[model samples]
Target chain A: MAAYVQDAIMLLGDSLTQGGWEAHGFAQRLSYVYARKLDVINRGLGGYQTDWAIPVFEQIFAKEHEQHHVPKVRLLTIWYGANDASPAPSPQHVPRDRYKTNLSHLIHMVTSPASAWYSPDTRIILITPPPVNTYQWDGRVFDATKSYAEAVKEVGLKENIPVADVWTEIWEAAGKDEKSCERFLSDGLHLNAAGYEIIFNTLIKIIGENYPELHYDKLQNVFVPWSEVNVADPRPSLVKRPAMIGLAQL
Target chain B: MAAYVQDAIMLLGDSLTQGGWEAHGFAQRLSYVYARKLDVINRGLGGYQTDWAIPVFEQIFAKEHEQHHVPKVRLLTIWYGANDASPAPSPQHVPRDRYKTNLSHLIHMVTSPASAWYSPDTRIILITPPPVNTYQWDGRVFDATKSYAEAVKEVGLKENIPVADVWTEIWEAAGKDEKSCERFLSDGLHLNAAGYEIIFNTLIKIIGENYPELHYDKLQNVFVPWSEVNVADPRPSLVKRPAMIGLAQL
Candidate 1:
């Protein structure tokens, strides 16, 4: 097995994060800014509600960690709610009461000592679903999203985790300009490149202010600098002893 | 070390591959298309010449394998030549003879028995640099890129590896219109989203036709479907004997 490991930050959510994987995309921006320092893993599952993801999270975080030699996860951004906010009739929708329960359970399962994937150093940031442009999301009810976002915020506060309120952040970034929502949400739901930009920038700023240690400049690259590479023996550079302590269950 | 290993496909190249990490980017498409099947790794280094990468290659591939547990690398794409095409005065430029030598060295090192990283079943593809709109890339002499591309094809032919001649393919895909070049390149040098779309589609098609086993439908996600998940007993899904035997040096 290869020994190279980078501290990873996970983007856990739904289609918004999936769409954020594009060029100039949200995850891509973080990747660009953080390059060798940390790998931004996109765990975004399109069309998924929080309920389905709970088990998937166990696989990716808990079970996977129990089995695989993947990198240590340093920061996990739990961004969900888009699909959960679907109308009650939609299969993707989760009832408001259950939604809050799911979010609260998710936070505790991942961060609490009662769970298998818990690591004291691993920071959890909950992100609410971004504001929806109703016309583009099959006439999705915008109020439903706000309510779900509120649920996420409540869990973040009760769980003592940081939160990136992309829902409010995106709308405010759009300002009073008419149709500016179009600039942010390409299909009134999924964000366009511009919409992701605001989210990406905002998250980076949040990390800088609240999780300064995770900042790009503060972290080390996976390997030695090009100048320090041993032209005659370069293997040592990529094989720095992995700093996995406190980062992974391993 | 983490025991779970994800089969990986490495995109080894320069800026095109690096920039290709964007939304609907080449690697992202592979990630989406191959989710749960194989991990698509971006080993793209910007502003790198093949010579500089040769040792770094050993560092990333061979030594790291000797030290840690990484998922097996089932497929690797060696895409280079863009930076090498920089004019004679540029530090990034390598002489024509040396460029071919470097490409040849790279192919053999990764594929032949002389290297520890070599595995007979590991598929290797050589991707020539994409079409360079001469006026956009420093008004570069077009013939230079064409020559380097031809050199890559020759190596691929001699080594019996697949070659993606993006330089020719993109141009033809654009239908040879006078300014069709503009549609494929964002800065007369790098590709825009439209151009990447064609590359992403073509690569997927190539995998379908040539590397059918690498197709998405044929692969398995890293875990069991949520329905089959034990909920009470989840580790078995992730600990399944790794399919890494024929895939990595490990």
Candidate 2:
């Protein structure tokens, strides 16, 4: 076993991120790529707006602050806007103005030294929501969501943070075909496997280009491979030590 | 937030269990089925034999015993033999006599009150490694694996724990078709998606029949739904307080 647990990629967002439960979705695929290297923690809170996520973030950071000799979070993803972009008639709506401010506030809390889990080492990425096809989604919400996506882009620029502009990526992949775009969203809101594939590939590509060290191949796998273990004294090779064997034998 | 985190179904084994990284693999499917109900912890140690797994189990159980107020593990699966079945000269080889004794010891450590992390309420399971085709696996090891499978069944009968009996199940499912059998084993030793599908479905059926309470729908999702939240005072609903809002809105 290795001497330490693996760090994690924190997936923090709303319903879109929640759809990651499917085996082929972004969450599982990323977990697979990083099999022994990282633990992917999904904190997707579907139907939630930024206002509520703030406190949730605070709670998580508080817990991590006290944790020592544990897997530190190396990457955090902030993806939202689906619920916040809900039209006025919907209970989930958070006005675009507040959404923009909340995005900035959330970023500051993580990167700023004043924050509870203050560490400049972790890379934070902002993900903008993709456009919902009006034919399947609420027209009002779809229109409003576009603005929210743009607002997210603006926050990324202002905060000097890496942003996975998923909205443009998906639309371009869909080309001009309306039916093709529909293929990306199961209900014109939440992503289908294809949608998640795009997100997964994009995230992998972005990390490969910008934060290459966080790539799956580069990150450390916790345990020493069984082949590498001192067969006579495997006990000393445990994960806390570095000789624990991973099931994948990767 | 949920007042408490979800319990887990622990998948412990060798390379076969490690194949659960796929979307349709037993791990992902179980996690999806238990989406908001329970967390599926994959503890598959690829390329390991029963003899090697002993210390790893001790390290794990030791950690869980002291974690008060944390999510409890309701199920534990012990799968092995593939690597142990390797023929003499193979570094993974473990004699049948030692394998059987090691399995019994591992089970006792988990269920016996004398051991740490003992929770009589938790259910333990033993999974036999499936028959390996000689063409794919080393001929000597393949023959030995059959005996190991039988040994697992014997242990299950003695311990009175549920066994997936995967070895028999796969051959029976293949009927008379050799190609059908090949579909389940991607490699001579490890399972393909089809093989894992059989494991996933079989586990679901077993849990459905014997432990219906553990069913996903029956288990409570942590925290309240967004609609249930008091818009004025959402903090009252955090996970530690039973007011957590799930991102999936499940």
- Winner by lDDT: 2
Q: Enumerate clash totals for all models, in the order shown.
A: 16, 29
Tens-digit lDDT track for model 2 on B67-138? 443445677888998888888777788888889899998888778888765666567778888878767655
Model 1 Cα lDDT, one tens digit per residue, B68-91 = 445567778888888888897766
Best by TM-score: 2
- DockQ (Cα-based) for each candidate: 0.25, 0.34
Model 1 agreement with the true structure over A42-85: per-residue lDDT tens digits: 76767767877776676566433442445667788888898888
Model 1 residue B227 lDDT score: 45
> How accurate locally, in lDDT, is each candidate?
0.70, 0.72
Candidate 1: DockQ? 0.25
TM-score of each: 0.79, 0.88
| Cα error, candidate 2, residue B136 (Å) | 4.0
